[model samples]
Target: MSSFDLRLLLDPPRYPANRYAPLADRIKRLLATHANVVFVQAEAILALEAVAISIARPGRVAVNVVTSPYGAWFGTWLSRGGAGVHQVSAAPGQPIDAAAVSACLERLPQVDIIAAVHAESSNGALNPLAELAALARSRDALFVVDAVASVGGHPIDFDQHGIDIAVIGAQKALAGPAGVSGVAVSARAWAHIAASPDVAPSSLSLMDLKRNWLERGRLALPGMPPPLEFWALEAALDRVEAEGIEHVIARHRQAARASRAGLRALGIEPWIARDEAASALVTSAPVPTGVDAHTLIADAARMGVELAPGYGEIEGRLVRLDHTGTRAKFDAVLANVTAYGTALERQRVDVDIGAAARAVNDVYAAR
Candidate 1:
């Protein structure tokens, strides 16, 4: 038998039930939001769905931006909640154009809510958040953002941006457990959510979280909370504070910058060519023709670098270099680029691996 007890992994630490509210507050501060914060026991997607179901009603009109599967699923949730949906879809894994959204809004429909993703990790696309917010404000509509991928990598001044409902997850840039997530809801959003006659009554209900948790002194959650996830989340918050949030964000940006530079030196093009439209969370590029992405990424993993393929519809078509939380460092960035270049070499692709390594080194040295 191994010296370490196996049971320890199952019961490492116990998270205090009462501290869940305080943990939620910590996430609120991370978001820089003044909105009412609700901690959900499930992952971010459920929190997103609850937000949509809460705001959607039969008479409501929503302009939903579809850039990836996550945004598409959000629109489905709104539709299921009886909202009249006007979808502004882009090419798969592409950011929605602000002009397209405005043109859609000008079609004489009174939009009650505007739903979009802040950044899409699937193809490293960063949506036009400010422009989308401005369009929503012009129509006097509630702006809902799924910031699952952008929270720590990008600055989110939630209240300052007038975001009515912003959904966040800990797994992406926060480097926390995937099981626990939170949402920030503004007063205007509450008014709309409270008006929904069919607001979810069970766990996927934001209104209940507000009434049962937020208004009731922010103690324990209504349902049984996941203790391990809460404990891990607390640790993540502590780590962020220790590292300084600004430094953490800067690291992700630096990693992205280096990865992009290295990719260019190797003759690989970023999927989102425009730096302005790409997210710092991950650097993505189309998979080289005839190269199996899974095999390439798996090969990279053997070299001590973690690489991922695109999600859903874009799977196998793109390869991504993640720079999330702890991995957003010069070493990680260099290793990622080097491993990919080497993996490509193994596939008989002529790549300038030496130049790519130099490019990554130059970026960090200059910084």
Candidate 2:
């Protein structure tokens, strides 16, 4: 192909071709079969809006169990959609127990939708989705999950888990560009939307998208999408399927194990007390005594190892390692860990560099 033609093919159009049906189909195939899925322009926020609108009624209540930053924002969106919102807050490093959620449901029998985060990127905590979904199912509430960071990094069986509406974005574990996001909607969720009296905003309406793209053929849509992004997403999904979701999840597990082992060997304790609750895609560690996490991260960036500083109240006190995306290669991880050890040594923090390397190597060898 000519350079100009390649450029044209590479650019995403201002409007989506087929009003995003092609991308939607790709997402549907990635998610559980026999589920009604939708593709949207806005991120998980849009999906949250759709879910909230679908379940909202004059006296109906929605419960948002928050263990991460995104869940809090999603709670706000739910409230604005005209539902009575109840929040169950958990500490950043801990996962909210399913028993607690069930208890909440018992107390508030009017809750029609139960929203939770699958993997919390802010504190590297992952909630027990299977348990939470079972609790929601027992309560007869629509289970809405924000799996943006967890879907590709971990195994998410939407149907098996009773996830009625699951939202995901492309930028995190999917390693795709921004501006595209997806949602897996169960048949029950569509029924809820169909029965709701509230009218959603034209562009943000899931029902409208479903009627236009899914019920009606794509050729009938008014505008066309950017073929490049659609094609890119298709290719990315193809790559993920080729690698196998199980293998992808295993790789993330290996990365997390290596990271935690290395950090412990360096006398660094993970922020989350339980290793099982922590996500494989990222890890958070307390700053060493006499060393500021913000300063260490800044210094590490200069050494070509970019580490995420802590968020919210933990800022400057914790360091986070994001092993998500295409950059989670074993070699890159080893290099980053070694660089961190070297940085700590320069600051007079005693670290056995050999031990750190060995810890990571041992994890890889065992696998």
Query: For all the candidates, what are their Cα RMSDs to the real structure?
Result: 1.9, 3.4
Which pairs of residues collide in model 1? none
Pairs that collide, model 2: 13-226, 15-225, 16-224, 16-225, 17-224, 17-225
lDDT (10s digit) by residue, model 2, range 256-317:
88888888887777788688888887877777789977678877888888888777766776
Judging by lDDT against the true structure, name the best candidate: 1
Local distance difference test, per candidate? 0.87, 0.76
| Candidate 1 local lDDT, 60-90, one digit each (tens) | 9999999899998999999998999999998
| Worst window of 10 by summed lDDT in candidate 2 | 218-227
